[model samples]
Target: MATDGIEAVFLETHNWGKSARFFQALGFELDFATDHSSGRLRNGQGAYVFIAEVPEDHKPGMQVVLTVPDAEAFRPGPDVEVVTPFEDTHFGTRQATVRDPDGRLWNLQAPAGN
Candidate 1:
């Protein structure tokens, strides 16, 4: 269900810096960072997603983020499930999280300053 283009993808990790730097070394720019709950990393092109550490007791590696436009306007289509509601990020953008029937995660974000 790609609308415009690939926006952002998140990699959950216990170490945000390592992961963030890894992506940065690969040419991704750091747009913003947050430690409100879990740490987050955004790329230069406006693709900022998350990479959080899984709780020791919780299952690991079962989330994905699908980037979309106007996260607030995106409605649940078919098997989609809204996990996180659209809200302003500390980095100053509107973002939301959702899940597919398979439990795969998706993230929707509007353009910067939108």
Candidate 2:
């Protein structure tokens, strides 16, 4: 099946509180925060943003995720590079990685199982 389109954004930051506040000031509300200084924020009915803290040495980056009703049923076109096959994520979802023609990586996520 085809993808459902942009779902969420995975943002990495060295300072979780500051990053969260930045989004909050933009009208996003906290959905939940993990004990390890990570959280998800939502604004209205749009895509949610997940902010996670990483080590200072790690370069912070943002990733856009596309949602599929079922990972097992999703099949990408030839132009897309399958970096990693669908796998289970620690957050209780099935996820896969694919690359665009420009070499940027993107995520495909689906709920647990069929």
Candidate 3:
């Protein structure tokens, strides 16, 4: 009915490959890469995170992904807007995006196979 805490944290990097490797060296495992410029790493539990290449237009920063029972059910609040509709990822998860008042993007993800 309500969103739990953060499910993942998305880090925007100029070089996703290098950032992924750095996180791996810090004890994370490469979960999968959706494409050449973006991928995911996890600590082998529930601590999965993402590394994405920032476009020239989109300001880069931390994107806190929330755990909602159903990403499809999360309606955009009063001032928020749906940036990206829910879709299945290559790594096997459902994800969508929303924007806060300040325009910071937040990714909402449902567990893989849900």
Q: For each candidate, give its TM-score against the true structure.
A: 0.51, 0.95, 0.61
Residue-wise C-alpha lDDT for candidate 3, range 1-114, written one tens digit per residue: 456768888789887878888998999998889756998899966757888898768877887888877765666666668788888998678888888778777888886655
Model 3's lDDT to the true fold? 0.80
Q: List the residue pairs that clash in candidate 3.
A: none
Clashes per prediction?
8, 0, 0
Candidate order by TM-score, highest to lowest? Answer: 2, 3, 1
Task: Report, for every candidate in turn, its global Cα lDDT versus the true structure.
Answer: 0.62, 0.93, 0.80
Model 2, 7: alpha-carbon shift in Å?
1.0
RMSD of each: 4.7, 0.9, 4.0
Q: Between the candidate structures 1 and 2, which one is better when assessed by lDDT?
A: 2
Q: Candidate 1: lDDT of 35?
A: 59
